[model samples]
Target: MCGGHSRGHFGHHLPMGIPVSVPVEERRSSPVDVLNERLARGEITIEEYQRMRSVLDDQYRTKHSPHIRKPTTA
Candidate 1:
């Protein structure tokens, strides 16, 4: 068991047949979100931001639509 129960592995119960310790709210920011923030901060041009966003959206749809998984390195 994990979470609010016995520490099965690193103080988290195994669910989805995987060992996860971090809470959902503690996860890192998404790439798109980070890029958006940069755009808001005037660190990147809208053209560049939109291009990266399109690429990220494609990868997200391919790999993260049915099942949620960690972000890819590529």
Candidate 2:
């Protein structure tokens, strides 16, 4: 049960073909959302955005990967 944690979109209790169980047209923003919004506001350079994006991606994976790919027992 993975410590009874509910990761919403990342929950395994949901059906297949659904990434984390989020509905169509609805995707939660990563921690980089604020930075991304800033980028949209022309507050950051493309290179900086790309660089920060990579870092945030790494962070997201590190935090969520453990619970994301579970080994099923069948």
Candidate 2 lDDT for residue 45: 95
- Per-candidate TM equals 0.49, 0.46
In model 1, where do residues sit more than 4 Å from their true spots? 1-27, 65-74
Residue-wise C-alpha lDDT for candidate 1, range 1-74, written one tens digit per residue: 43357564453433667765679678798898899889999999999999999999888777867576557798
lDDT of 1: 0.79
Q: Clashing pairs in model 2? A: 9-20, 10-20
Top lDDT: which candidate number?
A: 1
Candidate 1 least-lDDT 10 residues: 6-15
| RMSD in angstroms between candidate 2 and the native structure over all alpha carbons | 15.9
